[model samples]
Target: MERVHSDRSEQLYQLYKPLLFSLAYRMLGSVSDAEDIVQEAFLSWSERRPETVLNEKAYLCKMVTNRCVDRLRSPGKQREVYVGPWLPEPLITEALDSDSPSGAYLQKESLSTAYLLLLQQLSWVERAVFILREVLQYEYDEIAEIVDKSSSNCRQIFHRAKRSVSGLSGMADTVPLKSESLKALIEQFIHAVASGNTGQLMNLLKADVSMHSDGGGKVTAAVRPILGADRVIAFLMGIASKAPADMSFRIQMVNGNPGIVSYIGEQPSSVITFRMENDRIAEIYIVVNPDKLKHLPQR
Candidate 1:
């Protein structure tokens, strides 16, 4: 009986791992933290005697939720320990890359780092409630169970969180510029930067453009977000002009859009990805701080 129960518990965990990770990632906006929480949740389950368990999925989910809530309540340790500019850890095309795993379709908007940062604005419980209801389509009852709250309470939290996130949710669906289009746009962007063509760059930006970077304190990057087309263009050119000639870069598809691969003497220095919203680019994410890029796979 014990062995059979153990097998069942393991099977249940396997079934829920991806879903739990997705929820955690959405809540924390950090891949590493999400992974850690998922692992810890499973560990919590493993330590449990399978025979004593009931509703394995619910139990595991509560563990994951509890772990995330703990992190949310006390994030100083995580934030204080972080080095440099902390970007949401990037996942390769293999991880969140496929919109459907069996179908192997690339998720156009999944790569947008913009959505993750926006998620940061909500409280811990609010983030969990919103993701569970909005992103995953979990009903209020299910969410209430996971968070140890009443369904009515979950609804209220969801409402407030939805309002907070609605404006930014449009950013979640940003389509990455395709090869030819992105190549042209990147050329234009880079050329504009090289020539200080703020006009040309501004023309390429959408109404509410925002740019962010993760130099992680190791490299020099904007400590704050750059907003608006004109301001973003100015910032881009400044970075371009300062880049060492030998600090050459190559263009690659990152987060499903045309991105720059910064190199120093053939070693990868950083990856800069753009989040596009039609004719104008919306967000620019530069991940130059090396430590954070360690988990990023070769694209």
Candidate 2:
């Protein structure tokens, strides 16, 4: 690869930063690591001459992918060293805008909390294959080149990845509905919890509503599931008490669903998402672990 001049490199970095960041983030499931990987790719690009570079986009993307694959393979140590539980980095996007079926946001399954949680179940290769296939739709050959594997090997990896991600032997059409009834139920439930209106919340909650928290052991939380509406409420209040003193709550669309964030000193500290069934809220997932909230930047 030929070295790019200083000015040319700046332009190239600006041009590719968004693409690289998105690719790295999705691949690694770590915003900080993704940013680091992209930066490293650019550094590698700089070290080579522009004369040596034949295909800039492909080269940069491949660099990022290779680094991400190694990181994925290497994170067992960090996962082991991590205190308590670990969760995926949280990122808040603009509300599920205009799901009228023509929007750019992948409306395939309405980015819900349930969906992201399921993503946690996939192996790194499977996640990478599924993301490239479903989210980016790259050809298997191109994917093989990026991952440095045989075409057949890549196909097999993708096949298994597809099954793991979809949790089915075959692909399913996963269109999500924007149920107004579910939103109403959750809004009322949040009010009940925030305002300590337990009676109204109880009437609305199921007898066995399950609640989970990704505290990452930085803060005290239930290591296992907290079952029942009564127990769920108690657990949530405990979380509220531990929230930063100046923290404020707001409702936002995250992963394409109604979600909550706690902003302490005007920076996001936590994000919570809900799962609903038949117009009623079924589960509440709280992600307070600082490592995961880095992606939800204020801007």
Candidate 3:
């Protein structure tokens, strides 16, 4: 009987781990912290009396959600004092595309850096409520139960959060180009940068394109967002000119979009992901913080 119970617990963990991790990652915006919360939730679940739990999935989700809220609400979290413009730790496509029963809830747009940063603008509770309703398609009652709020209150919070992020959400609604097309554009971008073809690069970027680099004060990076196509091209060229002779670029799926990863002799030096508007790169997110890149699959 003890062995059987252990097997059952293992099955339950396997069934819900992905869903719980998705919820926690969206709420906390840190891959490592999200993973820690999910692990802690399962540990707590294992200690609970089986008979007392009515719905396993809901109970597990509630556990993960509340823990994420607590982590976000904790005083002096790193984001408050993060060096330069902060970007969420990149979640590579393989991890994002892992097989899971609740995979439908993990919408591609919701996982983008732009969307995650917009989520940061909301209050912790509001972020939880919005993600539950908007991304996960939870009913109001379900969200209320997870959040420990009244159904009506959850509805109100969702609406308020929706209004706050409506602009970016509207942009997200645009139909994305086919994957092949995006890859071709990325290839063109690489060639343009590598060959010092400013005119070609200018045509690939939007007039108002902006680039953000997050180094976490551990490496050299721009302290402020670089704006406009001309400035962005100049910055890219400047980096290209100074980059080591051994540096190489590879295309990888980053946050559900094709992106570039730069390597300096097998060590990942940077990960770059782009946000597109009308087939042009509108926003570029480059994460160079070594601490953040530790989780990336080694070359």
Best by lDDT: 3
In the range 1-299, model 1's lDDT, one tens digit per residue, is 66876786688666787778777776666668888998888777766787676666667777887888788678574665655446666644433445453113234444356666767778888888877787677889888888889999999999998888777566445554566897788888767777787788778888678888887768777887888877787677777777787776666665445667767666677777776777567777878777667665543
Model 3's TM-score against the true structure: 0.93
What TM-score does model 2 achieve against the real structure? 0.78
Tens-digit per-residue lDDT, 169-241, candidate 3: 5584667777679889999999999999999999999999999999999999999999999999999999989
Native RMSD of candidate 2 (Å): 4.3
- The predicted structure with the larger TM-score, 1 or 3, is 3
Model with the higher lDDT, candidate 1 or 3: 3
Q: Name the regions of candidate 2 deviating beyond 4 angstroms.
A: 1-4, 75-77, 95-113, 168-175, 179-185, 202-208, 240-247, 264-267, 294-299
Which candidate should be chosen as best, given TM-score against the real structure? Answer: 3
lDDT of 2 by residue, 87-193 (tens): 55655555434643222433334245565556556776666666666766778877777667777888898888766766631225433347455556667877887
TM per candidate comes to: 0.78, 0.78, 0.93
For model 2, what is the C-alpha lDDT against the true structure? 0.69
> What are the Cα lDDT values of the candidates?
0.72, 0.69, 0.86
Off by over 4 Å in 3: 1-4, 95-107, 168-173
Q: List per-candidate RMSD values in Å.
A: 4.0, 4.3, 1.9
Candidate 2 Cα deviation (angstroms), residue 262: 1.6
Q: Where does model 1 exceed 4 Å of error? A: 75-86, 94-111, 167-200, 227-231, 242-261, 265-267
